[model samples]
Target: MSESAAPGALEQVRTFLNTWWVPNDTRAPEDRLPALLADPAAWQADLPAFAFPGREDAPGMAELRAALRAALGEARPVALGPWLARHPLRAELSADPDRPPLALVPEDGTAGGTILAAVAEAVRAGQWARLKACPDCSWVFYDHSRNGSRRWCVMNPGGSESRGCGSIAKVKAYRERRRITS
Candidate 1:
């Protein structure tokens, strides 16, 4: 998992968006959703909010994942209207006066609804724009920077230097510039 996860419920959206794994191996990168959906325990372990997903729900989950990837990665906007319409969340009043008055709940009690709800919440909090996808590796990461102008994933996550997409892309750009000048 990347250390650049968004704070609060937005972390769930970031986590779901980052499921498309690209390892540092020669083999082609792949989506981890299929394998994750096959195992119910894995679903609970990774996303407890998306609990008890069955094999039948795999297609929907995959579709949602793809739509989200496009929305995060591509220039064109992905119309999530149909999906959001299908999985609607109901507004509930909170018991605690200190807490926010309204809460959104999944009408269908599915993970998709929960994800959509989280997305809505993040948008409400104005943190949705901070979630970004790395151009080099297409990995989703949250920009926790104060200025909110962060465009790449960190080169070092846990203080040790690694070939994260940010450093790799900078190196490639540098090489290209040098090659042009030479």
Candidate 2:
């Protein structure tokens, strides 16, 4: 897949969580995520609110991300209990008033909340185990294969420079193999 294609919600949240280690300063590991999200005008429709909290006090974003990354890397199903309390969703009533309540939505409206919600949704759909990171680039992507064994981001050979990690790693492996063989 080309880099231009936007990721699905599950991948979007995973990518967002991966940015916890990065601060929006020099754009090294990644751009200033918090700052970008702060721009309401920039947020595309259908995405969760961009105003996620992270300042002097930590919002558990990093820890949550680390735990998720570790579990995904190990190809295991993560128990959602520890995070449920902190990122609780508000129960919503149905419009008809005669029907049951609608699905719960995040109370805080922060990106972290959105991401966590996505994880919960994925789990319920039996798709959480398919959300994974590219070992070469740490970029999160969904494994759409029948066996759910896909690795590497969906990008092809000419993927943008910002996403050259997979290509670079492939080249390195090729060279190492050639050296060992010769």
Candidate 3:
């Protein structure tokens, strides 16, 4: 329960998806995902928060978050029935090897597997998108680019082309310049 402990497996997976794709201010280290999966209960108290900015009241989301946190903490993947009962997203996972495992895809897709597969393919072809955290929110996301030089969180409306931390410095410089001129 301590804040510094690693998150459980389900929480790790959820955190990876929620942060890696959508980008958030509260993402854990990328390596934490596999580590937590190897040991679900290795960290219980520090699991990432699952609440999205605009979807806190969505039906079943809270329960789903709790269930995923608990299940990933287990020694093994919990049965599908119980997991699905708490979160319908489990239904999107199929037995097809061609698809990505249910754990990888977002709910907006028909099946998580397909999206997962695409991510893998993109990664293998050296086409995997680079991601950067939001300077303000710390959200993670794939940076779609040929040169892969993106540095801002696309999910945030306020995100500027200038790097988050760098933008602050620019503002300070502008004010100092104006002060000297005046």
Candidate 4:
């Protein structure tokens, strides 16, 4: 993993959940989830590769995305408990017994076959949270924080911190106010 990459298994899962699954201005809104599941390579060119320890194919990627979409379509929150109940990653994280403590498996399926497995374990263990789609944008992300108060998409440049859709109206209000003052 790069110096700036997520530090551990949980962090790695958090990063992937938050960053990889979302659509931004560059990628069309409708293409985000499908592109990530069916053809990760399409987005790979733009993103820093995820590095775990033992690398193998992860079936969970597609399964989880499908499940998430189904839940979202139904207007239900994707809960981590139900997700892990269906898909488990324990065996994968333990692929390399000789590797260093907290050694992560690279995500490109090159290392051995442990990265996705570890991610599964983390999700099962509740180390990660079920991410909700942004109210403004349909992007999904893990709420890693304690409060679970996150609501906006990080993939968006302004994200939750800014006014987002509310900004356009705010700008119009300011312009109208200035006109009146003039």
Candidate 5:
């Protein structure tokens, strides 16, 4: 709940979803596990509130990561009507023209509710295919590209970057094609 809560909501959701790499391979590194297992209290304290009020069963890191992975694995367009109906969202309409008034207040145990709302909001804003999980790294990212055709996570997405297997896989395909042609 910082000074920029409203505008920062979507970014906060994006940041939260990017927490773990839901490994696509057996050798997947645990970028999110060590810290979470090491210290639960501190980890929860560090989570972003986004634009929503907090709720009970706020979900441990593992659960939250699982939901994100599950959604990506479904690999389909978000149909938020049913999801929204399941959760009791507390929000108010806005009178201001330049601002969005969808402030979500969850009653309880709707840890994944924020994400669904964010997805709905993004889709409502015409960002139809924003969420993407890299097939190689298993890292989730928002596709900010104009055409929404981004297919891989960043090669280096902050400290201690992943091997960018998505890019590596592309190169492997190219090499195989050359071998066949040669």
Candidate 6:
């Protein structure tokens, strides 16, 4: 995994989910998947962890992205069950006794199946529940806080950059409080 990514295969899920547009971010305010679908090489470059879907699989990928976004936004894993059912995983036995016995692999070569498999693996690892969409900007992020109580995406954890929905939400709440007080 790269330095920017979450640990283990959860990074794939995080990256996939974060492809959705955020309104106030410096990045383009548009869903990135469309451009990626138009150019498979760019998609592969960005998401090297998963299989790049063929042009024919673009619709399935889009549907999967929507389903994933909805599931994360609502904090409901059940929302993904039907979409995930279309991309079943195959269990591969592991050799080491200390590790998990079976590893879930994508049943097909499409990006949707690979990401869905990653989601299943993340769920099994107890990390899927931590992946959430920021209520303020709808940006998907993995909450790595110790208590798992993080509610917004931090723009600058160490004052590195002022670009997160958390900062914007705090400002809005502060303004609202001031207005009420006045």
TM-score of each: 0.85, 0.62, 0.28, 0.41, 0.63, 0.83
- Range of the 10 consecutive residues with the lowest summed lDDT in candidate 3: 2-11
Which candidate leads the pack in lDDT? 6
lDDT tens digits, residue span 1-182, model 3: 42111223322333444422222243343333334334435323333322221233233333443343233222232443453332233234578897545544434432222323333333334433343334443444344546766554442234343235436545777999999999
lDDT of 6 by residue, 1-182 (tens): 32234667778778777778565635446688888878879888888988778766678887888888777634347877786677778898998996578888877767788888878777777777788777766767777778877777665444433356667778889999999999
Clashing pairs in 2: 24-32
Give the clash total for candidate 6: 1
What is each predicted model's overall lDDT from 0 to 1? 0.72, 0.58, 0.37, 0.43, 0.55, 0.73
- Top candidate when judged by TM-score against the true structure: 1
Clashes of 5: 0
Candidate 2's residue-wise lDDT over 47-155, tens digit each? 3433435452144655666667776634334555576677777766677765345545677765566667666656655777776777665666667778877777644
Ranking by lDDT: 6, 1, 2, 5, 4, 3
lDDT of 4 by residue, 1-182 (tens): 42123334544444444433334454444434344445556434433344322223344554554544444312223453554444333322345567444443324443113334545444445543444555554545455446766555442235433335335445677999999999
* lDDT tens readout by residue for model 5, 33-52: 44544565644554545332
Model 4 misplacement above 4 A: 1-28, 32-64, 69-119, 154-182
Task: Tell me how many clashing residue pairs each candidate has.
Answer: 0, 1, 10, 14, 0, 1
The stretch of ten residues in a row with the least summed lDDT in candidate 2 is: 19-28
Stretches > 4 Å off in candidate 3:
1-122, 154-173, 176-182
Q: Candidate 5's C-alpha lDDT?
A: 0.55
Off by over 4 Å in 2: 1-8, 18-28, 37-58, 73-80, 89-104, 107-111, 159-168
Model 1: weakest 10-residue lDDT segment is: 156-165
